[model samples]
Target: MTEVRGRMWVRGEPADGFTFSAISDCLTSEDTLVWADIYDPDHDTLTALAEELKLNMWAVEDATAPNERTKATVYRTHTFFTVYAIQMLTAVGDSTSTLVKHRISAFVLPRGLITVRLPPVAGDDPGFGMDEVSQRFDELGGQQYGVGALVHGLLDVVVDGHFDAVQDLDDGIESLEDELFDEDGPKRGLQRRTFRYRKDLVELRRVVLPMREVVSAIKSRRLDAKTSPELNPLYDDLYDHVLRASEWTESLRDMVTTVFETNLSLQDARLNTVMKKLTGWAAIIAVPTAITGFYGQNVEYPGLNTVAGFVVSSALIVLLVAVLYVMFRKRDWL
Candidate 1:
């Protein structure tokens, strides 16, 4: 699917077709500011656009590839940027799984912006949606500012998403911490929760950390001369957001680690307590076992024929066990 926004430069009006020919004609006929958004463009479409825009073959190939790391690269007359958009799906069983990420690639030029997106699976929301953003841009009269404002708007949405995801992770960690420390309550699946949160944090970091460098490159004005000066500040703001997101991700990872360690320590302590109790009970039972074993002998034993002997022996076993229990209790060992 292809979407075109904005008016023709020559006619100063919105253009119709978003194809390579239409866009090239619009750019040539007049100085129109247009944006062409492509969703999973076909091979032929990609090749045609690359040829028309003179995009590097390597960069085009990279854009088509899956799970490419987030980064920005500058080529002659155009700048290419790839970024990941993350969305948290519903919590499944013990873990909260995230929907597959969308890899969005943008070709930034002076007159127009071309974006390529990988469509989401059925019933999944595309991480980057332009409905609200487009409305906001139109409300602000975005045509006057060209594509720079549009780029900023889109990035702003992505940054907000990061903030929400981080906040959810923090909430999950806090809940796990409470469960870990609960004295009278069962842990209630806390181990599984912590493991799941850790996994999500790792994945989120992988997507967000490299975006810092991508945004910084743009803010540093390292792109080709065709990039508009007005876009620099927007990129700088986006860079700041990326830095903040990275910091939050790092902090969340540390918290997950701490939660895991604390859980292990708590489990170890519980095990030790159980072992101590079992050891105490074993010691208490040993005296009876020893006394009975001696009295059960068939050989000529004095205790075998006498009721007094049996009573004395039984009394001795009970007394010995009581004494041992008292000693253990006094020493705070049980």
Candidate 2:
């Protein structure tokens, strides 16, 4: 079922409950910031809201488009911004888990914010939504900025979600590194785990790298009064986080690749060591086989068919075998 999550904040406090259709009534002052959130709404619902809000039809179409890159677009009266919130990536129930990119498009008006969320149909939960974002607004009760503060809160939550995912990936990589050297840990799942981590890092980089440009555009374009001078510090902090998330993901990818290569090298070295032992033992055994075969020949040869000669040949075989065994063992080929 589709859900519409929204709130009206007046004078930095949440006003009484109001419907999305009555959004215009909420914009009573320069201090008012109206936020409306919808998830996977039908065409009729979106069309009605677009007409009600006077939003550009082209921006609405882009919002409803199936796939969108993280970007910011300017319109005559407002700006359209699209961003993503990361859900998670994990192993669940033998299926291929995915990195959930919860696409959220925003209509940044001078005094209002309208958001549309395109979440996966199933199992892509990161336990965050507009309710959480609205709380950030309410938490700042009695302090008023404008639409810029609200936009910063939204982007902050999204970027913070990516930060958490990056931290989780780092922990997984650390644990895998430990298990790589552990002798008793189960070895069967290491390959799958490493591959999943690498895949997730790639996906994360795709999502996070573009965010730097998105925020910078919003900060620089000064879309209407939405880019207030007071918001400079907050947006600057958010840009720093985006930079950190992108750099961390690349470093983690390199680490995972190194671990995977080192594991293969260790396996090959072990195989070579086993082969050396087998070859050394084969050489030691061939000495006895050659002496017995020569002695058992039907024709006469030296040291055959006589007790004294047989004893001397037997001693000769034992001495040669012992000498070879000592040499091989000294060379660590046993």
Candidate 3:
């Protein structure tokens, strides 16, 4: 099983793991700043945290659920946020078929922050990069940073993930375009990939758009007094990042739609080409069919008795078909 525990960061230093009994001790510790990070804790641990931190039951429930929508909530003394971090795979083998997303729940209190990360399932570790943000927070000296800064740093990582996923999508689209236009290639695979990419973009937008509101709420300073005024700028910076990410997602969605439309148009053009070829052959054969039917009639006909007449009739039919074919070719309809 994946291990779960809480680590306390105080004034750029990490305290050993904090247990239930240690909670009050750590809370009373003489640290200018302290953060409690919980990694995939059990229900009991969540309950204890909820009680100790005075977090709303609903917020704790949402935190434990994996499919919770990206959102922000203001508790009596803390702000909670749920954010999604995306990881894209573009490998050529079995790895290529899998897409992984990491959903992280964050709780920001007046004196501390809590991050709960769920471990990846077997064969599906897309890996999270929370360490980088934690390191940066530590390096900056945690006391100087408020909960808003912590939230911003974490969100920055998440948005960076979005940027990387979008870049991967862009590269995938370019490859798909190449395959679609290749003269001797089959386009079905490219078309399928386009549809899949469009779906991915849609899902990405679903997760990202709500996050815009979450960041906006923080930047607007809607949180209670537990949130510091100095941290408003940090939230503002995060809001800008969310705006940029939203714009990028919209642009990518448009690009995916364009690719899908282009693929459909190509398919339609191909179908039309096939139909034209069949129609042209049918027209050519119709000329011979009519001539043979008329000449083969039982009644005495002007061209029926003479071999020369038969040859002339046949030549006329062939000549008519050849001329029609050339006309169609010149008109660019064949």
Candidate 4:
């Protein structure tokens, strides 16, 4: 019931309410191109569209399933593309934001473009930003370029998302770098934050890395509705954005790794400093213990068992410890 069809752009003229039931009716003139947007369709609805549109059964299966990796698969009459649209949620304190991937599947048919958006998942799943996608489509106005225009607009939206997510991750890494040096910052949280960055980047990279192949597959003119030579420049621009996102993420992953290793090094240095201070103090205290043991011997030569000898021994112990203390303090070993 949430399903809705967008106003069709035929050549340069706009028409509305081209339902799936009536899809068999002629919507495509030589210059007419139909674009349909479906949201969270039920099983019966998908089956019905598949029957009417002659969508490949395997492609329909993949469309309904969640968690499909980003890919492009070519069918006889249509090409199916699986792509993710990303939305970020900010976390509390110094931690980086969370990334929510909304799964989107598209079928590039000969005469039209069909976009199927999965429903929002539980928790902080930011549903696909349909408004931005719609705004991009609306920009077509009178310059409709058939199905190519629709596919271009939609892919443009998705690629921009990848770029934004990568940039946000870069910013998060920069913030983490600042806290890494701060003396008063929470050491434990910094460690956890870096780990989070590594994890998030891995996930982001997984989603983003395949986008190059997906976009390239389309730009290479393998699909029925692949970019025309006129639209090749646009697809090339999109490919450039994809490449930048992929490369930036690669460098960020290494940065996160460095942060983790540097934290370990810092911790080891701190432990060594603490252990050195403890050993110096223990050495200073041992001088008194050894003097007392010497004085307690049964057979002694110098003033054995006398009050004057006891005072002299005590004074010598105090003077020796004081000298050691001064030396240790001056050397900063205590």
Cα TM-score per model:
0.85, 0.88, 0.82, 0.87
Q: What digit string (tens of lDDT, one per residue) describes model 1 on residues 139-243? A: 545444555655666666767677778888888888887887787744667777888888888888888888777767655544322444665666677778888
Q: Rank the candidates by lDDT, best first.
A: 2, 4, 1, 3
lDDT of each: 0.73, 0.79, 0.72, 0.79
Model 2, 111-162: lDDT tens per residue?
8888887756565366346776777766644226777777888888899889
Per-candidate alpha-carbon RMSD to the true structure: 3.4, 2.8, 3.6, 3.0
Cα lDDT of model 4 by residue, 1-334, tens digit? 5676665655557766577666545344656667777888787888888888788988888998978889998777888999999877777654554878888898887667788888877655667757777688777442355666677788889988888888888897888778777887445588878877888899999999999999898777544334345676777898998998899999999998988888788778778878989988898789888988888888856978789988988898899889988998898888
In model 4, what is the error at residue 212, expressed in angstroms?
0.5
Q: Give, for candidate 1, the lowest lDDT window spanning 10 residues.
A: 3-12
Model 4: how far residue 323 lies from native, Å = 4.1
Clashing pairs in 3: none
User: Highest TM-score among the candidates is held by which one?
Assistant: 2
lDDT for model 4 comes to 0.79
After superposing candidate 1 on the true structure, give the runs of residues whose Cα lies further than 4 Å from its correct spot.
1-21, 29-31, 121-128, 139-143, 184-189, 222-235, 301-303
Model 3 TM: 0.82
Q: Estimate the TM-score for candidate 4.
A: 0.87
Off by over 4 Å in 4: 24-27, 92-97, 140-143, 222-228, 292-315, 326-332
